[model samples]
Target chain A: MNAAAAYLTSFLRASYRDAVAGWNRFWFAPTDPATLAMIRILAGAMLLYTHLVWTIDLEAFFGPHSWVSPTANATFHEVPKISEIMEQDPYRGRSFVWSLFDVAKTSQQIWAVHIVALVTFALLTVGLWTRVVAVLAWIFAVSYVQRAQGALFGLDQINTMLAMYLMVGPSGACYSLDAWLARRKNPRRGAASPSTSANIAIRLMQLHMCVIYMFAGIGKFVGASWWNGTGLWGGVANLEYQSLDATWLAYWPHLSAFLSHLTVYWEVFYCVLIWPRALRPWMLLIAVPLHLGIAFFMGMITFGLIMLVGNLAFVSPESVRATVSWLFRRTRPAPTTGG
Target chain B: METSSRPKADDRHQACCPWPNELRIVVSLLLALHVSAIYVGPFSMGAMGVTSPLALTLRRTYRPYLEAISTQYQGYQFFNEPGPSHLIRYELEFADGREMVTGKLPDIDEHWPRLRYHRHFMLTETAYTLVSRTAPPTPPPGLEVGTPAYESWRQFRDADAALSRAFLKSYAEHLMSVHGASLVRLYGIERRYPTPEEVVDGIRPGDKRFVSEELLDTFTIDIEVVSP
Candidate 1:
């Protein structure tokens, strides 16, 4: 009896150790920082551009006399049940968050805050003072996002998310003014070694993307239209959202069905298919066109582009470095000295 | 491509990576919490039950808070439900008896300018979402005068409907004022259109050409009139 108990204890200990070790290796393994930095530049540009869209009718959405007056906006935040789901008020700012809305009572103040946000976004894109400004950029993203809660959509939500995760790591590690400054400070040294920070950030993004797509795919089952392939038509047929009306596809029901089914299956199984190195290229091939199609045909250009950017986490760092090098005419950091 | 050699602790330029076992454990825990924070929302909504006793208790306690935060981050259930789509159009009669009509608040120009105005329609859609997407409370059985639950719903309906009306009034005022009208009587309506497939399938009669404008609300702006 005593011998059997001792063997069981040993087996349990070994199993626990093995599990912990595997978890550590899977998540904390060092990875190159290039992909994350590239994502920052692209996503930051997206953030800047999205906020830039707000400028066309600056006060129409936020001013007291505007569409959503301050009183209505406050009701949107304070009212329970309705606001919780509909308004999507951020929990952190129930009482009030620093919106340019509060101080930008006048159109001049509104544009002033808007310009500062744009500058911050530009800096974040180029990776200047990233550690500090990334947080500031997040503040800007959140403030505008919550303030413009009425106008929010998939584009704003995902933009704010990428902004949050970008702040999690050393996102300025490459393809940035900060990266060049680092090399300038230590010119003799080759590019720095891969860090656990980059790996963790990429892992979180990958995981978060999985959650998004999985739920997005699953959510379709709730609707009768998705089952019948009518939901896909709904996007194009709705004249309000239609840009390049391909409702002509009504005659080609077979093609419409194929594309609709492809989207659902691709999204539902993305998290699994994405992990395999061999399937990675194929998944991207399907995803890029799917997103670009939405942008062009469906008229949700920013939302579609942001969705594509979310998939950028799956891209390998080496490819990012090569692309950057190609663009800048060999301006990237010297190839790494260590693996 | 990664280089042949590996980085060392005493490298010429330092790289800070928390590579210790304890730190990795901490990271694992943090990642787990973060992932869980996102997961619980879709799970609870999708009926992916947590069967374990401890898990169920923890979920029951923290699920509401997490649902709010998670939704704020990414409510990616876009187009999961299918229904009639609407566009608001307003017609205004100035005190001088001249009348004006506009597509909606956004009525933005073509190309890039249209993207900016998508927000106006988004606001209207949100009101529709609040009204239609939410499961209306099952009116409670006791109907003497004012049961607490019924009263709560009564208050909600008034607030919710009033909001929709208020938005119509405000935008109507602003848009009409732009047309050189000081005082205007405005009536708002929505054009309800069916999906392409709906028309093709004849879900109802006249689906193909079914374009009906539902009267949303009628109100006065900077002028006294009968309540609508």
Candidate 2:
């Protein structure tokens, strides 16, 4: 009895130690900011474009008499009163969401706020004072989403998620105007040093992405079509969602079923498989086609592209740096040696 | 494209859990709390009507933080069901005896750049989602009134009715203002997708047979538009 107890205690001790070590290594280890910087440029560009598109009908959608009226918008953001909470109302009240648009009542005010938002997004994209703009970008992104609650989908969610995480790290450490300006000021600075904050931000994004896919996959099980392998057909045959006329997929039922099954399985397992170095690439590769397919075939180009940008969190800084350097080298003219 | 090259000596030294132990512990706790919150959002919104009680509790606890950060609605349930899409069809009547003008919430021709069209598409879809929740489940025959079950259903019905009214009325007033009309009629249209068998049988996806419409509401200019 004494020997068995001792062995059990030893095993538990080793397990706890290993778990703590792994957790610390995963979240706190310093790393290059390259991946975060790349994501900033891409996600910031997406944020800029997304807000720019709002310019076409800014007054109609966000003006005083907008699609979602002020009263209804207020109702959407209402939180449960203290009395209701104390009474244990089963149906929790709406959330207490904040938005800058809440204060911008007039068309002129809305346009002024919007132009500032656009400029902020552009600055974030160019990596100009990214530390400040990244936070503002998130605030603006969330404001737009909260104000126009009815006109949102996955695109806005992913876009805001990327922007939010970008604020947690030094997203403009490299490949940014900030970096160029820094170099011009002091030519002695080496490559951006590894950063613990960068690692934390990337890890958070990677974990958030895993959560998204897990839910997305699990949610499909609720539908009857997803079960009998007819799910892909449902999306493909939907006239409203089709961008490229993929009804041709009707002729290939078997292939359609294969893809539908593959999608669910990939999403469900991504959280697990993505952690292993060997499996991470395969997971990311699968994400490319899956997102691109949605972009081209489903008419949600922005949503699909933003999701791919979120997946870039799984990519290593070294890989991003190497790939970018290779592309630049291929594009630039070769140096001529003195004859 | 991943490389397995060894880190530089300095990078390796710095990578060894560089944060002080106290900071590491603090962040670890926060990280655990955050990840749990993230998991709880969708876990409470479980698939196949299977929400766990634990998930619901966690969701309630984290609701404020999640909302403040605008991460509460990240269900990520993309194409989960892929059911019928929705649109709002409207007709306007002017006071001067002008011919009635008709339009749709998301006329692709008018709403250029697919994103704009998608935004309008989401408007109708959001209306449908909100209105659908207003329908309470039918009570069993001979079920007693004032019981817990009946009270729950009654409360849900009342709450949902108020919510849907606010949403539909706002939309109605917007249409009236846009058309400069005295009266506006709105209809919710649901367009179901064609099945594979239907497609094989030469039926197109956009056939009128698959479309159904219901009158959502009607509004006059006298309906009070709330000031911002």
Candidate 3:
């Protein structure tokens, strides 16, 4: 009996040690900031463009006489009394959801805040004062989403997700104006060092993406169309959602069904398959076609593009740097031979 | 000439695990709490109406943090069940005896740069979601009226009605303000897509037969607000 107990204790000890080591390695290991920097430029550009588009109808969406006026917004954000009775009121008596628009009651005030938000996003994109601007960008992104909850879609969610994580790391460590400024001040400074914070940021983005797809895949199981593999047909035939007419897919039912099944299987297994180095490439490659298809075929170009930006978290810093360098080399003029 | 001072392979390897043990522990604990919050957000918004009690508890515990970050509503269920699309049709009557003006929420020609159109599209969809409350579930066997189950369902119904009225009224008021209109009427239109069989049968996806409309509400300019 003593022998058996001793063996069990040893096995438990080994397992516990292994688990701790794995956890530490996964979350704490330092990584080059190249991947995070690239994500920042892309995501920041998206945030800027998204807010810029709001300029088209600034008064209609965000002004005092906006689509979702302050009074109506208050009602929407109020905790339902029924939820309170059931002890399920997430916000209790008061709401924590906030936005600058909550206080910007006048058109002038709204426009002022909107301009500042646009500038913050542009700064984040250019990597100027990146740390401060990254945080500001997140605050502004969330503020817009919270205030205009009626006009949101997956694009805003992914935008806020990317912006939130960008604040968690040294996202301007390289490929940024900050880097250039630093080099100008001290000509001998080396490339940006690796950082645990960068790793944490990228890991969070990758895990969050996995959670999104996992839910998305599992959620489809509740629908009969997904089960019968006609889910793709539903999207293709939706006149409102169609950007480019893909009704031709009606004739290729087998191909449509194959794509539908492939999407579900890929999304469901992404979290598991994406961790392995060998499978990671295949997973990311599949993302391009899936997301691009949505971008072109459906009318959700911004949503599809932002999702692809989120997927970039899975790419390694080394790979990002190599790819960027290769593109620059191809773009640069060949060195002319001196006579 | 500028010399590249990139770190060597050995240097890079050495830099991989530079965090002190104490910092690692703190961050690990924080990460554990954060990732738990992240998972709980979607888990609480369960698939197939099968949320676990544990997910609810965790979500409640993390509610404040999630709300502050505006991550509380992270369902991530994009196109999970792409069903019928929605649009709001509005008719406005001006107090100045002007002709009635009529329009849709997302007139494809009026809203440009697809994203703007999408925003308007979402407004109609949000209205549909708010107003389209299903019938309350039938009470379980042996549970008659006035029981806890029945009362709970009744409270939900009442709350939903109040919320929907608030949204529709606000939308009506906006239209009145926008068009100098004293009277506003709003309709929720559900645009169902054609099935593959229907498509093959020469019926277009946007056939009027597939469109269904329900009058959501009608509102007049609030006398109190207009006089004040």
Candidate maximizing DockQ:
3
User: Each candidate's DockQ score against the native complex?
Assistant: 0.32, 0.51, 0.52
- Give the CAPRI rating of model 2: medium
Candidate 2 overall lDDT versus native: 0.85
Please, what are the lDDT tens digits per residue for candidate 2 over residues A1-339?
999999999999999988877787788888999999999999999999999999998977788777888788777666332223334534466555788988998988999999999999999999999999999999999999988978899999889889989999999999999999999999998999999999999999999999999989988888787878888888778877888888877788898889999999999999999999999999999999999989988888999899999999999999999999999999999999999
Candidate 3 positional error at A283, Å: 0.9
Number of backbone collisions per candidate: 0, 0, 0
lDDT of 1 by residue, A1-339 (tens): 999999999999999977865676667677888888988998999998887888776777766566666666655655543333332334422443345466667877777888888899999999999888788787788777666656777888788778888888889987789888989988985774687878888888888889889988887776677777766776776666777867777778877777777888888999899999999989988989988888887788888888888898999999888877787876756778876
- Candidate 2 regions exceeding 4 Å error are A79-95, A334-339, B1-15, B48-50, B136-143, B224-228
Query: Model 2 TM-score?
Result: 0.93
Q: After superposition, how far is residue A317 of candidate 1 from its true place, in Å?
A: 1.0
Model 3 misplaced stretches (Cα beyond 4 Å): A81-85, A88-91, A337-339, B1-16, B48-50, B134-145, B223-228
RMSD of each: 6.8, 4.8, 4.9
- Reference contact recovery of candidate 1: 0.41
| Interface Cα RMSD, each model | 5.4, 2.7, 1.7
Chain A agreement with the truth for model 3, given as TM-score: 0.97
C-alpha lDDT (0 to 100) for residue A256 of candidate 1: 76
